[model samples]
Target: MIGDPKTGTLQHARIEGVGHEGLSCSAVDGRPLEFALLDPTTGEIVEHGPHVAQEAFNVARQVYRNVMKGQGWLRVLSEPAPLTARKAA
Candidate 1:
C-alpha cells in the first residue's frame, strides 16, 4: 500500500439520495469508497456506500497513513509492506 499521504485515503464525494420519488435528499456521510478499505483481502464494499457502512473510514485512515509516508495510491485489496526492511539472517 505504498502511496502518497495526500488522497491516500481514497476519499469519495458525498452520496445524495433521491427522496419521495424525486425529491432531493441530504448527502450521505463518510464518502462512498471507504467501506472497501476495511477488508484488505477482498476489499469488497461490505455495503453500497462508505458512509452508510463503517468500513470506509477505515480505508480512509489507511489512505491517509500511506500518503503521509510518501506513498502512492493503493488499493485496499493490495498488500501493505513494512516501512523499513530488516537485514536477512
Candidate 2:
C-alpha cells in the first residue's frame, strides 16, 4: 500500500499488484487524509468527510494474505475483520 503519499486533496498509495510475491505496507511521508472525496467542479469538499481512505489501511492489512497471492480480486471475506483479532498466539 506504499506509494506517493501526496496526491493533492486525497493523499494515498497506488498498488500495482505486480512484481515479486513479497509485499509490504508502510506509511511514508505526510499524514492520513482528513477527507475522502472532493468536488472538482465546485472546488469544495463534502461537508462530512468520509473516512473510507482511513479504513482502506485496515481493510488491506486484514486481507494482506490474499493480496500477496494476487487474490485481491477474489471475495475473501464478507466484511473487514480486524487483524488484531486474527493475530496468532
Candidate 3:
C-alpha cells in the first residue's frame, strides 16, 4: 500500500520461487521476524518483516531492474547521456 504508487505498473522480477522459511521465529519472543524472498532466476534476494513487506518488495524489484539494465536486457529511456563540457572560446 505504501511506496511508489506506480509500483504495480512497472515491470517486476520474474521470481520462480520465494523462500518464506526465514519468517519463522522462536517461541520466546513471539514476534514476527525478517525473512528473505529469493528469486531463483537472478538470485536477487530481499528480507522483509512484519508490516514492511511492501517496501522490501520494492527494493528487491529495483535491484532486479538494475541488474537487468546492467545486463542490457532492458533500457531506461530517462537515463541521462554522458555530459561533455565545452572549451572556453
Candidate 2 structure quality by residue, lDDT tens digits, 1-89: 48866533423543222233323232345433343445878877643233444344545555776767887654444454578876853
Model 1, stretches more than 4 Å misplaced? 1-52, 78-89
Error of 2 at 46 (Å): 2.4
Instruction: Give the per-residue lDDT of model 1 (tens digit) for 1-89.
Output: 34643432323354332322221222246432322223567776444443333344455566767877878866554333455642332
Off by over 4 Å in 2: 1-33, 47-53, 59-64, 72-89
Q: With candidate 3 superimposed using the best TM-score fit, by how many Å does residue 51's alpha carbon deviate from the native?
A: 4.8
Ranking by lDDT: 2, 3, 1
State each candidate's clash count: 12, 0, 0
State how far residue 53 of model 3 sits from its true place (Å): 0.2
| Per-candidate local distance difference test | 0.43, 0.46, 0.43
Tell me each candidate's RMSD, in Å, in order. Answer: 13.9, 10.6, 15.5
TM match of model 3 to true structure: 0.25
TM-score of 2: 0.28
